[model samples]
Target: MLRLAALDGQVSSWLDLFGPIVFYLIVWGLVFAGTGLFVGVFIPFITGDSLLFAAGILSAGHSGINIWVLAIGVGIAAFLGDQVGFLLGRHYGRPYLDRRTGAWVQRSIRRAEKFYTDLGWWAVVVGRFIPWGRVLVPPIAGIARMDYLKFVAANLVGALVWGVLLTVTGYFAASIPAVKSAAYVIGGAFILGAIIAGILSWRRNRAAV
Candidate 1:
Protein backbone atom coordinates (compact mmCIF):
# COMPACT_ATOMS: atom_id res chain seq x y z
CA MET A 1 0.00 0.00 0.00
CA LEU A 2 1.14 3.55 -0.74
CA ARG A 3 0.24 6.79 0.93
CA LEU A 4 -0.19 10.02 -0.96
CA ALA A 5 2.54 12.45 -0.01
CA ALA A 6 1.26 15.57 1.66
CA LEU A 7 2.61 18.79 0.29
CA ASP A 8 3.11 20.19 3.77
CA GLY A 9 4.60 17.12 5.37
CA GLN A 10 7.94 17.43 7.15
CA VAL A 11 9.18 14.20 5.59
CA SER A 12 8.75 12.66 2.16
CA SER A 13 6.75 9.65 0.96
CA TRP A 14 10.01 7.78 0.49
CA LEU A 15 10.53 7.86 4.25
CA ASP A 16 7.49 5.69 4.55
CA LEU A 17 9.05 3.00 2.37
CA PHE A 18 12.35 2.75 4.23
CA GLY A 19 13.90 3.47 7.58
CA PRO A 20 15.56 6.85 7.97
CA ILE A 21 19.02 5.38 7.45
CA VAL A 22 17.92 3.24 4.56
CA PHE A 23 16.18 6.15 2.97
CA TYR A 24 19.33 8.22 3.10
CA LEU A 25 21.32 5.36 1.61
CA ILE A 26 18.84 5.10 -1.21
CA VAL A 27 19.24 8.81 -1.83
CA TRP A 28 23.00 8.36 -1.92
CA GLY A 29 22.78 5.55 -4.44
CA LEU A 30 20.39 7.47 -6.64
CA VAL A 31 22.72 10.43 -6.55
CA PHE A 32 25.55 8.16 -7.63
CA ALA A 33 23.78 6.38 -10.46
CA GLY A 34 22.06 9.53 -11.63
CA THR A 35 25.36 10.93 -12.85
CA GLY A 36 27.96 8.17 -12.68
CA LEU A 37 26.12 5.39 -14.46
CA PHE A 38 26.10 5.01 -18.23
CA VAL A 39 22.34 5.34 -18.08
CA GLY A 40 22.64 9.13 -18.21
CA VAL A 41 24.32 8.89 -21.62
CA PHE A 42 20.97 7.87 -22.99
CA ILE A 43 18.84 9.77 -20.46
CA PRO A 44 20.11 13.04 -19.04
CA PHE A 45 17.28 13.79 -16.62
CA ILE A 46 18.84 11.53 -13.99
CA THR A 47 21.09 14.30 -12.67
CA GLY A 48 20.85 14.90 -8.88
CA ASP A 49 20.25 18.57 -8.17
CA SER A 50 16.78 17.83 -6.88
CA LEU A 51 17.90 14.80 -4.97
CA LEU A 52 20.81 16.60 -3.40
CA PHE A 53 18.61 19.48 -2.35
CA ALA A 54 15.97 17.20 -0.92
CA ALA A 55 18.51 15.03 0.82
CA GLY A 56 20.16 18.04 2.37
CA ILE A 57 16.91 19.30 3.81
CA LEU A 58 16.13 15.90 5.27
CA SER A 59 19.62 15.53 6.71
CA ALA A 60 19.20 18.70 8.76
CA GLY A 61 16.78 16.94 11.02
CA HIS A 62 17.30 13.64 12.87
CA SER A 63 17.18 11.91 9.48
CA GLY A 64 20.17 9.70 10.37
CA ILE A 65 22.01 11.03 7.32
CA ASN A 66 25.07 13.05 8.15
CA ILE A 67 25.48 16.26 6.18
CA TRP A 68 29.18 15.73 5.80
CA VAL A 69 28.75 12.22 4.45
CA LEU A 70 26.10 13.24 1.98
CA ALA A 71 28.17 16.12 0.68
CA ILE A 72 31.43 14.22 0.37
CA GLY A 73 29.85 11.06 -0.98
CA VAL A 74 27.84 12.85 -3.62
CA GLY A 75 30.90 14.87 -4.63
CA ILE A 76 32.96 11.73 -5.15
CA ALA A 77 30.17 10.05 -7.04
CA ALA A 78 29.82 13.02 -9.37
CA PHE A 79 33.54 13.17 -10.05
CA LEU A 80 33.68 9.46 -10.79
CA GLY A 81 30.55 9.62 -12.89
CA ASP A 82 32.10 12.24 -15.15
CA GLN A 83 35.21 10.15 -15.32
CA VAL A 84 33.18 7.32 -16.81
CA GLY A 85 31.59 9.70 -19.30
CA PHE A 86 34.98 11.14 -20.25
CA LEU A 87 36.48 7.71 -20.78
CA LEU A 88 33.58 6.75 -22.96
CA GLY A 89 34.15 9.89 -24.97
CA ARG A 90 37.86 9.26 -25.21
CA HIS A 91 37.53 5.68 -26.37
CA TYR A 92 34.22 5.25 -28.14
CA GLY A 93 32.76 8.71 -28.45
CA ARG A 94 31.84 9.37 -32.07
CA PRO A 95 31.58 5.75 -33.16
CA TYR A 96 29.14 5.10 -30.39
CA LEU A 97 27.32 8.30 -31.22
CA ASP A 98 26.93 7.19 -34.82
CA ARG A 99 25.29 3.98 -33.68
CA ARG A 100 23.20 5.68 -31.01
CA THR A 101 19.50 5.95 -31.73
CA GLY A 102 17.36 8.83 -30.52
CA ALA A 103 16.83 12.57 -30.82
CA TRP A 104 17.53 13.13 -27.12
CA VAL A 105 21.04 11.73 -27.30
CA GLN A 106 21.81 13.68 -30.45
CA ARG A 107 20.55 16.95 -29.06
CA SER A 108 22.47 16.48 -25.83
CA ILE A 109 25.57 15.66 -27.87
CA ARG A 110 25.31 18.88 -29.83
CA ARG A 111 24.65 20.97 -26.73
CA ALA A 112 27.52 19.32 -24.89
CA GLU A 113 29.92 19.93 -27.80
CA LYS A 114 29.03 23.59 -28.04
CA PHE A 115 29.23 23.97 -24.27
CA TYR A 116 32.66 22.44 -24.16
CA THR A 117 33.93 24.48 -27.13
CA ASP A 118 32.73 27.76 -25.66
CA LEU A 119 34.19 27.21 -22.19
CA GLY A 120 36.94 24.66 -22.83
CA TRP A 121 37.98 22.98 -19.53
CA TRP A 122 35.67 25.27 -17.64
CA ALA A 123 32.71 23.48 -19.21
CA VAL A 124 33.56 20.49 -17.08
CA VAL A 125 32.83 22.64 -14.01
CA VAL A 126 30.05 24.78 -15.44
CA GLY A 127 28.36 21.74 -16.90
CA ARG A 128 27.91 20.44 -13.34
CA PHE A 129 25.15 23.00 -12.88
CA ILE A 130 23.31 22.12 -16.12
CA PRO A 131 21.10 19.05 -16.20
CA TRP A 132 21.95 17.59 -19.58
CA GLY A 133 25.30 19.31 -19.60
CA ARG A 134 26.29 17.53 -16.37
CA VAL A 135 26.04 14.21 -18.14
CA LEU A 136 27.19 15.16 -21.62
CA VAL A 137 29.99 17.70 -21.18
CA PRO A 138 32.42 15.20 -19.69
CA PRO A 139 32.32 12.87 -22.62
CA ILE A 140 32.62 15.75 -25.04
CA ALA A 141 35.66 17.00 -23.14
CA GLY A 142 37.21 13.59 -23.47
CA ILE A 143 36.37 13.44 -27.17
CA ALA A 144 38.24 16.70 -27.69
CA ARG A 145 41.20 15.07 -25.93
CA MET A 146 41.36 17.71 -23.22
CA ASP A 147 44.36 17.08 -21.02
CA TYR A 148 43.50 14.37 -18.49
CA LEU A 149 45.17 16.01 -15.47
CA LYS A 150 43.52 19.34 -16.13
CA PHE A 151 40.14 17.70 -16.46
CA VAL A 152 40.72 15.91 -13.16
CA ALA A 153 41.63 19.14 -11.37
CA ALA A 154 38.68 21.06 -12.71
CA ASN A 155 36.40 18.12 -12.11
CA LEU A 156 37.49 17.87 -8.47
CA VAL A 157 36.91 21.54 -7.72
CA GLY A 158 33.54 21.53 -9.45
CA ALA A 159 32.32 18.40 -7.70
CA LEU A 160 33.29 19.56 -4.23
CA VAL A 161 31.78 22.99 -4.66
CA TRP A 162 28.56 21.70 -6.16
CA GLY A 163 28.09 18.98 -3.57
CA VAL A 164 28.96 21.10 -0.57
CA LEU A 165 27.09 24.23 -1.52
CA LEU A 166 23.79 22.59 -2.48
CA THR A 167 23.69 20.27 0.50
CA VAL A 168 24.70 22.97 2.98
CA THR A 169 22.14 25.36 1.60
CA GLY A 170 19.47 22.77 2.08
CA TYR A 171 20.70 21.97 5.57
CA PHE A 172 20.50 25.57 6.67
CA ALA A 173 17.10 26.04 5.08
CA ALA A 174 15.75 23.49 7.54
CA SER A 175 16.48 25.99 10.32
CA ILE A 176 13.91 28.45 9.05
CA PRO A 177 10.24 27.96 9.96
CA ALA A 178 8.55 29.15 6.79
CA VAL A 179 11.36 28.18 4.47
CA LYS A 180 11.80 24.76 6.03
CA SER A 181 8.15 23.89 5.57
CA ALA A 182 8.14 25.06 1.99
CA ALA A 183 11.40 23.32 1.20
CA TYR A 184 10.15 20.06 2.69
CA VAL A 185 7.18 20.19 0.36
CA ILE A 186 9.36 20.95 -2.61
CA GLY A 187 11.93 18.34 -1.70
CA GLY A 188 9.29 15.66 -1.23
CA ALA A 189 7.82 16.39 -4.61
CA PHE A 190 11.24 16.28 -6.22
CA ILE A 191 12.15 13.00 -4.50
CA LEU A 192 8.97 11.31 -5.62
CA GLY A 193 9.49 12.60 -9.11
CA ALA A 194 13.12 11.49 -9.18
CA ILE A 195 12.07 8.03 -8.02
CA ILE A 196 9.60 7.77 -10.86
CA ALA A 197 12.18 9.06 -13.31
CA GLY A 198 14.72 6.52 -12.08
CA ILE A 199 12.29 3.66 -12.49
CA LEU A 200 11.37 4.75 -15.99
CA SER A 201 15.02 5.10 -16.91
CA TRP A 202 15.78 1.62 -15.63
CA ARG A 203 12.93 0.11 -17.57
CA ARG A 204 13.93 1.99 -20.69
CA ASN A 205 17.50 0.79 -20.42
CA ARG A 206 16.41 -2.79 -19.93
CA ALA A 207 14.19 -2.62 -22.98
CA ALA A 208 17.00 -1.17 -25.03
CA VAL A 209 19.27 -3.96 -23.88
Candidate 2:
Protein backbone atom coordinates (compact mmCIF):
# COMPACT_ATOMS: atom_id res chain seq x y z
CA MET A 1 0.00 0.00 0.00
CA LEU A 2 2.86 2.37 0.81
CA ARG A 3 4.55 1.48 -2.48
CA LEU A 4 1.37 2.26 -4.39
CA ALA A 5 1.07 5.57 -2.56
CA ALA A 6 4.63 6.49 -3.46
CA LEU A 7 4.09 5.58 -7.07
CA ASP A 8 0.99 7.72 -7.16
CA GLY A 9 2.91 10.61 -5.65
CA GLN A 10 5.58 10.24 -8.31
CA VAL A 11 3.01 10.24 -11.11
CA SER A 12 1.36 13.33 -9.71
CA SER A 13 4.72 15.11 -9.55
CA TRP A 14 5.51 14.31 -13.16
CA LEU A 15 2.08 15.50 -14.22
CA ASP A 16 2.67 18.70 -12.29
CA LEU A 17 5.97 19.42 -14.05
CA PHE A 18 4.99 18.65 -17.65
CA GLY A 19 1.24 19.13 -17.81
CA PRO A 20 1.16 22.92 -17.98
CA ILE A 21 3.77 23.15 -20.71
CA VAL A 22 1.88 20.54 -22.71
CA PHE A 23 -1.36 22.39 -22.13
CA TYR A 24 0.10 25.64 -23.39
CA LEU A 25 1.47 24.02 -26.51
CA ILE A 26 -1.86 22.34 -27.19
CA VAL A 27 -3.71 25.64 -26.86
CA TRP A 28 -1.22 27.31 -29.18
CA GLY A 29 -1.35 24.51 -31.69
CA LEU A 30 -5.16 24.36 -31.74
CA VAL A 31 -5.40 28.10 -32.21
CA PHE A 32 -2.71 28.40 -34.84
CA ALA A 33 -0.75 25.50 -36.37
CA GLY A 34 -3.49 22.90 -35.96
CA THR A 35 -5.73 24.82 -38.34
CA GLY A 36 -3.16 24.86 -41.11
CA LEU A 37 -2.05 21.27 -40.63
CA PHE A 38 -5.57 19.83 -40.57
CA VAL A 39 -6.42 21.84 -43.72
CA GLY A 40 -3.74 20.16 -45.77
CA VAL A 41 -4.67 17.41 -48.19
CA PHE A 42 -2.17 15.10 -46.57
CA ILE A 43 -3.13 13.98 -43.06
CA PRO A 44 -0.77 15.13 -40.32
CA PHE A 45 0.97 12.84 -37.83
CA ILE A 46 -0.40 14.57 -34.75
CA THR A 47 -4.13 15.09 -34.40
CA GLY A 48 -6.28 17.56 -32.48
CA ASP A 49 -8.01 14.85 -30.43
CA SER A 50 -4.94 13.89 -28.38
CA LEU A 51 -4.12 17.52 -27.72
CA LEU A 52 -7.64 18.26 -26.56
CA PHE A 53 -7.49 15.26 -24.24
CA ALA A 54 -4.28 16.55 -22.68
CA ALA A 55 -5.86 19.96 -22.31
CA GLY A 56 -8.68 18.34 -20.37
CA ILE A 57 -6.31 16.59 -17.99
CA LEU A 58 -4.51 19.88 -17.38
CA SER A 59 -7.76 21.67 -16.71
CA ALA A 60 -8.47 19.11 -13.99
CA GLY A 61 -5.81 20.86 -11.90
CA HIS A 62 -5.71 24.36 -10.41
CA SER A 63 -4.89 25.72 -13.88
CA GLY A 64 -6.87 28.87 -14.61
CA ILE A 65 -7.52 28.05 -18.23
CA ASN A 66 -11.18 28.03 -19.12
CA ILE A 67 -12.51 24.91 -20.82
CA TRP A 68 -15.08 26.92 -22.78
CA VAL A 69 -12.40 29.13 -24.18
CA LEU A 70 -10.40 26.13 -25.32
CA ALA A 71 -13.45 24.58 -26.94
CA ILE A 72 -14.36 27.78 -28.77
CA GLY A 73 -10.82 28.37 -29.94
CA VAL A 74 -10.48 24.82 -31.20
CA GLY A 75 -13.85 24.99 -32.90
CA ILE A 76 -12.96 28.18 -34.71
CA ALA A 77 -9.58 26.83 -35.75
CA ALA A 78 -11.11 23.64 -37.13
CA PHE A 79 -13.79 25.60 -38.94
CA LEU A 80 -11.18 27.76 -40.60
CA GLY A 81 -9.13 24.73 -41.54
CA ASP A 82 -12.11 23.12 -43.23
CA GLN A 83 -12.86 26.34 -45.06
CA VAL A 84 -9.32 26.67 -46.34
CA GLY A 85 -9.26 23.04 -47.42
CA PHE A 86 -12.52 23.52 -49.28
CA LEU A 87 -11.20 26.58 -51.05
CA LEU A 88 -7.97 24.83 -52.01
CA GLY A 89 -9.90 21.86 -53.36
CA ARG A 90 -12.24 24.15 -55.29
CA HIS A 91 -9.27 25.89 -56.89
CA TYR A 92 -6.78 23.07 -57.44
CA GLY A 93 -8.35 19.68 -56.81
CA ARG A 94 -9.86 19.11 -60.24
CA PRO A 95 -6.79 20.21 -62.13
CA TYR A 96 -4.61 18.01 -59.92
CA LEU A 97 -6.96 15.08 -60.33
CA ASP A 98 -6.98 15.53 -64.07
CA ARG A 99 -3.20 15.60 -64.30
CA ARG A 100 -2.55 12.80 -61.85
CA THR A 101 -1.74 9.35 -63.22
CA GLY A 102 -2.09 6.63 -60.67
CA ALA A 103 -4.60 3.96 -59.68
CA TRP A 104 -4.46 4.99 -56.00
CA VAL A 105 -5.27 8.62 -56.84
CA GLN A 106 -8.17 7.59 -59.03
CA ARG A 107 -9.46 5.23 -56.35
CA SER A 108 -9.35 7.94 -53.72
CA ILE A 109 -11.25 10.29 -55.99
CA ARG A 110 -13.88 7.67 -56.64
CA ARG A 111 -14.29 7.00 -52.90
CA ALA A 112 -14.73 10.69 -52.19
CA GLU A 113 -17.21 11.02 -54.99
CA LYS A 114 -19.15 8.07 -53.69
CA PHE A 115 -19.10 9.44 -50.14
CA TYR A 116 -20.56 12.71 -51.38
CA THR A 117 -23.18 11.04 -53.51
CA ASP A 118 -24.24 8.55 -50.87
CA LEU A 119 -24.04 10.58 -47.67
CA GLY A 120 -23.99 14.25 -48.71
CA TRP A 121 -23.88 16.64 -45.69
CA TRP A 122 -23.75 13.75 -43.25
CA ALA A 123 -20.42 12.83 -44.80
CA VAL A 124 -18.99 16.10 -43.54
CA VAL A 125 -20.36 15.53 -40.04
CA VAL A 126 -19.29 11.89 -39.84
CA GLY A 127 -15.89 12.65 -41.33
CA ARG A 128 -15.16 15.07 -38.51
CA PHE A 129 -15.04 12.11 -36.12
CA ILE A 130 -12.49 10.30 -38.26
CA PRO A 131 -8.83 11.37 -38.42
CA TRP A 132 -7.91 10.94 -42.08
CA GLY A 133 -11.50 11.31 -43.15
CA ARG A 134 -11.66 14.69 -41.43
CA VAL A 135 -8.56 15.80 -43.36
CA LEU A 136 -9.74 14.49 -46.72
CA VAL A 137 -13.50 14.98 -46.67
CA PRO A 138 -13.60 18.77 -46.81
CA PRO A 139 -11.42 18.84 -49.90
CA ILE A 140 -13.44 16.03 -51.38
CA ALA A 141 -16.62 18.01 -50.85
CA GLY A 142 -15.03 20.92 -52.68
CA ILE A 143 -13.89 18.63 -55.46
CA ALA A 144 -17.43 17.35 -55.84
CA ARG A 145 -18.57 20.95 -55.98
CA MET A 146 -20.83 20.68 -52.96
CA ASP A 147 -22.82 23.83 -52.31
CA TYR A 148 -20.83 26.27 -50.20
CA LEU A 149 -23.71 27.22 -47.92
CA LYS A 150 -24.53 23.61 -47.10
CA PHE A 151 -20.89 22.81 -46.52
CA VAL A 152 -20.57 25.75 -44.13
CA ALA A 153 -23.60 24.66 -42.13
CA ALA A 154 -22.27 21.13 -41.83
CA ASN A 155 -18.78 22.34 -41.02
CA LEU A 156 -19.99 24.56 -38.20
CA VAL A 157 -22.01 21.80 -36.62
CA GLY A 158 -19.24 19.26 -37.04
CA ALA A 159 -16.55 21.46 -35.54
CA LEU A 160 -18.71 22.38 -32.58
CA VAL A 161 -19.56 18.77 -31.87
CA TRP A 162 -16.03 17.48 -32.30
CA GLY A 163 -14.45 20.17 -30.12
CA VAL A 164 -16.94 19.83 -27.29
CA LEU A 165 -16.92 16.06 -27.31
CA LEU A 166 -13.15 15.69 -27.04
CA THR A 167 -12.57 18.46 -24.51
CA VAL A 168 -15.40 17.49 -22.23
CA THR A 169 -14.46 13.83 -22.35
CA GLY A 170 -10.97 14.66 -21.21
CA TYR A 171 -12.13 17.00 -18.53
CA PHE A 172 -14.51 14.50 -16.99
CA ALA A 173 -12.08 11.61 -17.28
CA ALA A 174 -9.32 13.53 -15.56
CA SER A 175 -11.61 14.42 -12.66
CA ILE A 176 -11.67 10.77 -11.65
CA PRO A 177 -8.81 9.86 -9.25
CA ALA A 178 -8.43 6.41 -10.74
CA VAL A 179 -8.28 7.85 -14.22
CA LYS A 180 -5.81 10.63 -13.27
CA SER A 181 -3.37 8.12 -11.82
CA ALA A 182 -3.54 5.78 -14.79
CA ALA A 183 -3.44 8.59 -17.33
CA TYR A 184 -1.63 6.42 -19.80
CA VAL A 185 -4.79 4.33 -19.94
CA ILE A 186 -6.44 7.13 -21.85
CA GLY A 187 -3.67 7.24 -24.43
CA GLY A 188 -3.63 3.48 -24.72
CA ALA A 189 -7.36 3.48 -25.34
CA PHE A 190 -6.94 6.08 -28.06
CA ILE A 191 -4.30 3.96 -29.75
CA LEU A 192 -6.48 0.92 -29.50
CA GLY A 193 -9.38 2.86 -30.98
CA ALA A 194 -7.21 3.97 -33.86
CA ILE A 195 -6.09 0.42 -34.49
CA ILE A 196 -9.68 -0.79 -34.42
CA ALA A 197 -10.68 1.94 -36.84
CA GLY A 198 -7.86 0.92 -39.15
CA ILE A 199 -8.92 -2.68 -39.06
CA LEU A 200 -12.52 -1.78 -39.83
CA SER A 201 -11.39 0.38 -42.73
CA TRP A 202 -9.25 -2.42 -44.08
CA ARG A 203 -12.09 -4.90 -43.78
CA ARG A 204 -14.40 -2.47 -45.55
CA ASN A 205 -11.97 -2.12 -48.43
CA ARG A 206 -11.52 -5.87 -48.71
CA ALA A 207 -15.28 -6.45 -48.66
CA ALA A 208 -15.75 -3.81 -51.31
CA VAL A 209 -13.15 -5.56 -53.44
Candidate 3:
Protein backbone atom coordinates (compact mmCIF):
# COMPACT_ATOMS: atom_id res chain seq x y z
CA MET A 1 0.00 0.00 0.00
CA LEU A 2 2.86 2.35 0.87
CA ARG A 3 4.69 1.54 -2.36
CA LEU A 4 1.47 2.12 -4.34
CA ALA A 5 0.99 5.49 -2.65
CA ALA A 6 4.62 6.45 -3.36
CA LEU A 7 4.25 5.51 -7.05
CA ASP A 8 1.07 7.52 -7.33
CA GLY A 9 2.76 10.53 -5.77
CA GLN A 10 5.67 10.26 -8.21
CA VAL A 11 3.32 10.08 -11.13
CA SER A 12 1.44 13.11 -9.91
CA SER A 13 4.67 15.00 -9.35
CA TRP A 14 5.86 14.25 -12.86
CA LEU A 15 2.55 15.37 -14.29
CA ASP A 16 2.74 18.54 -12.30
CA LEU A 17 6.16 19.24 -13.68
CA PHE A 18 5.27 18.50 -17.30
CA GLY A 19 1.59 19.37 -17.55
CA PRO A 20 2.04 22.98 -18.53
CA ILE A 21 4.53 22.17 -21.22
CA VAL A 22 2.18 19.63 -22.73
CA PHE A 23 -0.69 22.10 -22.68
CA TYR A 24 1.40 24.77 -24.36
CA LEU A 25 2.47 22.33 -27.05
CA ILE A 26 -1.12 21.38 -27.83
CA VAL A 27 -2.35 24.95 -27.95
CA TRP A 28 0.55 26.25 -30.00
CA GLY A 29 0.40 23.27 -32.32
CA LEU A 30 -3.23 23.98 -33.14
CA VAL A 31 -2.54 27.67 -33.67
CA PHE A 32 0.38 27.02 -35.99
CA ALA A 33 -1.57 24.38 -37.86
CA GLY A 34 -4.44 26.78 -38.43
CA THR A 35 -1.99 29.43 -39.57
CA GLY A 36 -0.46 26.93 -41.95
CA LEU A 37 -3.86 26.21 -43.47
CA PHE A 38 -4.68 29.88 -43.92
CA VAL A 39 -1.33 30.81 -45.37
CA GLY A 40 -1.08 27.74 -47.49
CA VAL A 41 -4.47 28.20 -49.10
CA PHE A 42 -5.20 31.91 -49.13
CA ILE A 43 -2.09 34.00 -48.63
CA PRO A 44 0.64 33.74 -51.21
CA PHE A 45 2.79 36.26 -49.39
CA ILE A 46 3.12 34.22 -46.20
CA THR A 47 5.30 31.13 -46.46
CA GLY A 48 4.92 27.97 -44.42
CA ASP A 49 8.67 27.41 -44.37
CA SER A 50 9.17 30.32 -42.01
CA LEU A 51 6.45 29.08 -39.72
CA LEU A 52 7.93 25.61 -39.60
CA PHE A 53 11.31 27.09 -38.86
CA ALA A 54 9.87 29.09 -36.00
CA ALA A 55 8.13 26.00 -34.66
CA GLY A 56 11.41 24.14 -34.87
CA ILE A 57 13.13 26.81 -32.84
CA LEU A 58 10.40 26.56 -30.23
CA SER A 59 10.77 22.79 -30.09
CA ALA A 60 14.46 22.80 -29.15
CA GLY A 61 14.59 23.01 -25.38
CA HIS A 62 13.73 20.52 -22.61
CA SER A 63 10.34 22.08 -22.00
CA GLY A 64 9.77 22.60 -25.73
CA ILE A 65 7.00 21.11 -27.87
CA ASN A 66 7.15 17.75 -29.60
CA ILE A 67 8.66 17.98 -33.05
CA TRP A 68 6.51 15.20 -34.47
CA VAL A 69 3.29 16.82 -33.29
CA LEU A 70 4.27 20.13 -34.81
CA ALA A 71 5.21 18.48 -38.07
CA ILE A 72 1.99 16.49 -38.26
CA GLY A 73 -0.15 19.47 -37.43
CA VAL A 74 1.46 21.62 -40.06
CA GLY A 75 1.46 18.81 -42.57
CA ILE A 76 -2.23 18.17 -42.14
CA ALA A 77 -2.91 21.85 -42.58
CA ALA A 78 -0.95 21.99 -45.82
CA PHE A 79 -2.61 18.90 -47.13
CA LEU A 80 -6.11 20.22 -46.47
CA GLY A 81 -5.26 23.58 -47.94
CA ASP A 82 -3.90 21.97 -51.07
CA GLN A 83 -6.95 19.78 -51.34
CA VAL A 84 -9.24 22.79 -51.20
CA GLY A 85 -7.22 24.61 -53.83
CA PHE A 86 -7.37 21.56 -56.05
CA LEU A 87 -11.12 21.36 -55.72
CA LEU A 88 -11.44 25.01 -56.53
CA GLY A 89 -9.48 24.56 -59.72
CA ARG A 90 -11.40 21.48 -60.66
CA HIS A 91 -14.66 23.32 -60.33
CA TYR A 92 -13.65 26.69 -61.75
CA GLY A 93 -11.64 25.50 -64.73
CA ARG A 94 -9.05 27.74 -66.42
CA PRO A 95 -10.89 31.05 -66.30
CA TYR A 96 -8.56 32.26 -63.58
CA LEU A 97 -5.59 31.89 -65.91
CA ASP A 98 -7.04 34.43 -68.35
CA ARG A 99 -6.69 38.22 -68.15
CA ARG A 100 -9.20 38.41 -65.32
CA THR A 101 -6.63 37.01 -62.91
CA GLY A 102 -3.89 39.17 -61.45
CA ALA A 103 -0.49 39.03 -63.13
CA TRP A 104 1.23 37.47 -60.13
CA VAL A 105 -1.46 34.83 -59.83
CA GLN A 106 -1.24 34.04 -63.53
CA ARG A 107 2.52 33.83 -63.40
CA SER A 108 2.36 31.44 -60.48
CA ILE A 109 -0.13 29.23 -62.31
CA ARG A 110 1.97 29.18 -65.47
CA ARG A 111 5.12 28.28 -63.60
CA ALA A 112 3.36 25.52 -61.70
CA GLU A 113 1.82 24.19 -64.92
CA LYS A 114 5.22 24.05 -66.55
CA PHE A 115 6.55 22.10 -63.63
CA TYR A 116 3.68 19.65 -63.82
CA THR A 117 4.23 19.15 -67.53
CA ASP A 118 7.96 18.61 -67.11
CA LEU A 119 7.91 16.28 -64.09
CA GLY A 120 4.36 14.92 -63.81
CA TRP A 121 3.28 14.00 -60.26
CA TRP A 122 6.77 14.53 -58.98
CA ALA A 123 6.19 18.22 -59.57
CA VAL A 124 3.58 18.27 -56.84
CA VAL A 125 6.06 16.87 -54.36
CA VAL A 126 8.91 19.10 -55.48
CA GLY A 127 6.76 22.21 -55.83
CA ARG A 128 5.87 22.23 -52.15
CA PHE A 129 9.38 23.31 -51.29
CA ILE A 130 9.33 26.23 -53.66
CA PRO A 131 7.72 29.53 -52.61
CA TRP A 132 5.23 30.19 -55.41
CA GLY A 133 5.23 26.51 -56.27
CA ARG A 134 3.58 25.62 -52.99
CA VAL A 135 0.75 28.04 -53.59
CA LEU A 136 0.25 27.36 -57.29
CA VAL A 137 0.77 23.64 -57.83
CA PRO A 138 -2.46 22.25 -56.44
CA PRO A 139 -4.79 24.44 -58.51
CA ILE A 140 -2.73 23.82 -61.61
CA ALA A 141 -2.86 20.12 -60.98
CA GLY A 142 -6.59 20.27 -60.64
CA ILE A 143 -6.93 22.29 -63.82
CA ALA A 144 -4.70 19.83 -65.62
CA ARG A 145 -7.13 17.07 -64.65
CA MET A 146 -4.56 15.11 -62.70
CA ASP A 147 -5.99 12.16 -60.84
CA TYR A 148 -7.32 13.23 -57.44
CA LEU A 149 -5.97 10.16 -55.66
CA LYS A 150 -2.52 10.68 -57.05
CA PHE A 151 -2.63 14.37 -56.25
CA VAL A 152 -3.64 13.69 -52.67
CA ALA A 153 -0.87 11.15 -52.24
CA ALA A 154 1.74 13.53 -53.58
CA ASN A 155 0.35 16.42 -51.58
CA LEU A 156 0.52 14.46 -48.32
CA VAL A 157 4.07 13.34 -48.99
CA GLY A 158 5.15 16.83 -49.93
CA ALA A 159 3.51 18.47 -46.93
CA LEU A 160 5.07 15.96 -44.54
CA VAL A 161 8.49 16.38 -46.12
CA TRP A 162 8.24 20.16 -46.10
CA GLY A 163 7.08 20.25 -42.50
CA VAL A 164 9.76 17.87 -41.30
CA LEU A 165 12.60 19.48 -43.23
CA LEU A 166 11.95 23.08 -42.24
CA THR A 167 10.99 22.27 -38.66
CA VAL A 168 14.02 20.07 -38.15
CA THR A 169 16.30 22.61 -39.75
CA GLY A 170 15.00 25.31 -37.42
CA TYR A 171 15.11 23.01 -34.39
CA PHE A 172 18.76 22.10 -34.89
CA ALA A 173 19.77 25.57 -36.03
CA ALA A 174 18.33 27.05 -32.87
CA SER A 175 20.89 25.10 -30.87
CA ILE A 176 23.64 27.20 -32.39
CA PRO A 177 24.11 30.45 -30.50
CA ALA A 178 24.78 32.46 -33.64
CA VAL A 179 21.69 31.17 -35.43
CA LYS A 180 19.56 31.82 -32.36
CA SER A 181 20.74 35.40 -32.11
CA ALA A 182 20.32 36.05 -35.86
CA ALA A 183 16.90 34.44 -36.14
CA TYR A 184 15.19 37.82 -36.24
CA VAL A 185 17.55 38.98 -38.95
CA ILE A 186 16.75 35.93 -41.03
CA GLY A 187 13.05 36.58 -40.60
CA GLY A 188 13.51 40.18 -41.65
CA ALA A 189 15.40 39.05 -44.72
CA PHE A 190 12.44 36.91 -45.73
CA ILE A 191 10.11 39.89 -45.48
CA LEU A 192 12.53 42.06 -47.41
CA GLY A 193 12.85 39.47 -50.14
CA ALA A 194 9.09 39.23 -50.43
CA ILE A 195 8.84 42.98 -50.82
CA ILE A 196 11.53 42.98 -53.50
CA ALA A 197 9.85 40.19 -55.39
CA GLY A 198 6.54 42.01 -55.28
CA ILE A 199 8.14 45.18 -56.57
CA LEU A 200 9.90 43.37 -59.39
CA SER A 201 6.70 41.63 -60.32
CA TRP A 202 4.82 44.92 -60.37
CA ARG A 203 7.51 46.47 -62.59
CA ARG A 204 7.42 43.55 -64.99
CA ASN A 205 3.65 43.77 -65.23
CA ARG A 206 3.83 47.49 -65.95
CA ALA A 207 6.43 46.90 -68.67
CA ALA A 208 4.22 44.19 -70.20
CA VAL A 209 1.26 46.56 -70.09
lDDT of 3 by residue, 19-136 (tens): 7455345434433333233344444323455555555665675364676766666676677767876776788877744533667666766777876665666667766667777776
**Candidate 2 lDDT tens digits, 1-209:** 35434433543454467674565455645433443454222323234556556566556664656667666776777788788768778888777445544675556556666665556676676666655557667777888898999999988877776666566566776667565435456545643554455456656767999
Residue-level lDDT for 60 in candidate 2: 63
**Winning model by lDDT:** 1
Query: Candidate 3: worst 10 consecutive residues by lDDT?
Result: 30-39
lDDT winner, 1 or 3: 1
State each model's CA lDDT, in order: 0.68, 0.62, 0.61
Pairs of colliding residues, candidate 3: none
Tens digits of per-residue lDDT for model 1 on 47-109?
A: 455556666777787556678887777787778888877888889867855565688778877
**lDDT score of residue 73 within candidate 2:** 71
RMSD to the true structure for each prediction, in A, is 11.6, 8.9, 12.5
Candidate achieving higher lDDT, 2 or 3: 2
* Candidate 1 lDDT score relative to the true structure: 0.68
Poorly placed runs, candidate 1 (over 4 Å): 1-11, 41-46, 177-209
Each model's TM-score, in the order given?
A: 0.72, 0.63, 0.61
